[model samples]
Target: MVAGRLSRYFGRRFLGASLTVFVGVFGLVLLVDYIELMRRSAGEANASALLAAGISVTRVPQIMERIMPFAVLVGAMLCYLNLSRRLELVVARSAGMSAWQFVAPAVIAALLVGVIATAVYNPIAATLQEQSKRLEDRAFNNAAQSGLQATGTGFWVRQRSVDGQSIINAASSTDQGVRLGGVTVFMYDLAGRFVERIEAKAAVLEEGYWRLVEARRYPVDAPPEKLADHQLKTNLTLAQVRETFATPETVSFWDLPFFIEMADHAGLAAAGYRLQYQKLISRPALLAAMVLVAAAFSLRFFRFGGVQKMVLSGIVAGFLLYVLSKVTEDLSKAELMHPAAAAWLPVFIGVLTGLVPLLYLEDG
Candidate 1:
């Protein structure tokens, strides 16, 4: 009964700390986003505060996505610091509880946050991101230039074709970005007349050429009746196709597989999507690692001189972990690293490094 009570107490403590951290961090993010929006609107003939506020609110989800790790760090720090300040940790230790036992609630909380983040927050963020793009289009009057809009219909991209001109509309892409689907390849000659149109059910981006499938070819000089289905040959490669469909963040974890398959069918490179897929599977471990990293810093609160120093150290550690994770992601996208390794390496390193302090403070 006493153990149950202790668990509940710790759980409540951790929950309160996490909530406080989230609110504080979110407020700061809102301020920064609002300021940036204001700066961008300056010197414009007219500005809409209401529009800016709505856009800023929409931007919150994206900012929150980036802020979650820091939130974990700060929240964990607060939980530990509070316990240490009240000597609750010492009392727990005296009662035969180890550092690990004291940290268990926080760790569980972090895991819950991770699950929620993957299943709920990420999808919401994806939606907000798409909305943000629409809002930007409304602001600029150029829907075509709007970037990274998420959709269940699959990823879409518009780009200029090679030879320095012409627009290509690709409804979907695959193979890390080497194939395209529902492709409409349009070209205009120097005379400003539509010179050619190539519509393909799919296009494969090979080494130096795009091989169109179920294609229809149209020549401006030819009679409409003369237009015929023909396999196409073009100089665009898989890499170039990938460049057009590059924002992997707009797709949710649950939707990545379908997107990847669509890309594969369209003959585009799916490497980035593939990497993101592997990363999502490893998220539980990553969450556990964040908890462990936090515990490592906070475990020494009794021995450390000041709570501020511990908090500072935790922030620095979190930043380094973030940087390492980004580097690994880049490596994975470039195909220079294994997808699993790139996704999990930071977590592995953080957990392993964190273990030393945990063991010393708790087990020893």
Candidate 2:
């Protein structure tokens, strides 16, 4: 019963501390976002434009969501540091609580925050990012061609043939860019002659060859009824197919598998999508690591007198860890590093590195 009471008490305290930290951080983000919007609006010639810009500025939270790990680190560090500064940590230790016991609540809180970020914040961020991009494009590029649009069933794309003159309107694509669904390839000679027409249910990209599925070929002089089901060949490769689709970020996590398979069928590399997939799976571990790292940096306040030094050290350590993660991600994407290694190595190293400082200050 005593242990339960103590745990509840600690939980409440940690919760309050975390809430305080989040508010402070979120306020700072809002302030910066507002200031940026103001600066951008200064050059605008009209009130309506400024209003639209202001509305777009609210999307900063989505950008900031990407930095949630940093926020968790800073917030958890502040929570522990504040507790230590108020002598609450000392009192808890005097009451027979170990350093680990005092830290357990904050660690758990950070993990919870991480889970919320992954499941909730990420999708919201993705949506807001798309909105922001669309706003910017409409504002700046009135004549720019929009990318392919997707529905629940398929996506549309436009690509140029190898001759770099003919435009292909592929109504939908599959097999990672290798296969075209509901395809209509319009062939025009240099003189814009109605040379030929090809219709196919699917088009599969192979090395220097495209295998058309249930295809019908028509020559300029041939009647439409004379066309027969036949395979059409092309010089397009898997790389060309994916190039027409653009980045994987436009697709949501739920849609990655389908795209990955499409890429595989096209004989193109799906390394970027693969990395994102692995990273998504490692979300829980990454969040747990952030909490541990935060604990390691801030849990020393009881013994350390140099607040500025510790804060700077924590910031530097966090920055280095983030950089390391990016480098590992790049290497993994390049196929030079194992997917598992690229995804989890930084987390493992961060946890171990964090534990060393925590142990030295709290236990030793």
Q: Which candidate is the best by TM-score?
A: 1
Q: Tens digits of per-residue lDDT for model 1 on 218-316?
A: 777774332234434445444445445656776777877777887788787677888877777767667677777887887665655775776677778
Q: Which runs in model 2 stand beyond 4 Å of their true positions?
A: 12-58, 141-246, 301-304
Q: Lowest-scoring 10 consecutive residues by lDDT in candidate 2? A: 139-148
| Candidate 1 vs. true structure, TM-score | 0.74
Residues 1-364 of candidate 2: C-alpha lDDT, one tens digit per residue: 5545665676676667656766677777767765665575565454245544544554665656556667667766777787888887777766788767766766676667667765676666555555554454334332122223444434444334444333355545433455555666666665666677777765667666566666676768976633334444455556556645545554456656776787777677778777766666676667567667777776665565777677778888889888998999889878999877887888788788777877886768
Q: Estimate every model's Cα lDDT from 0 to 1.
A: 0.69, 0.63
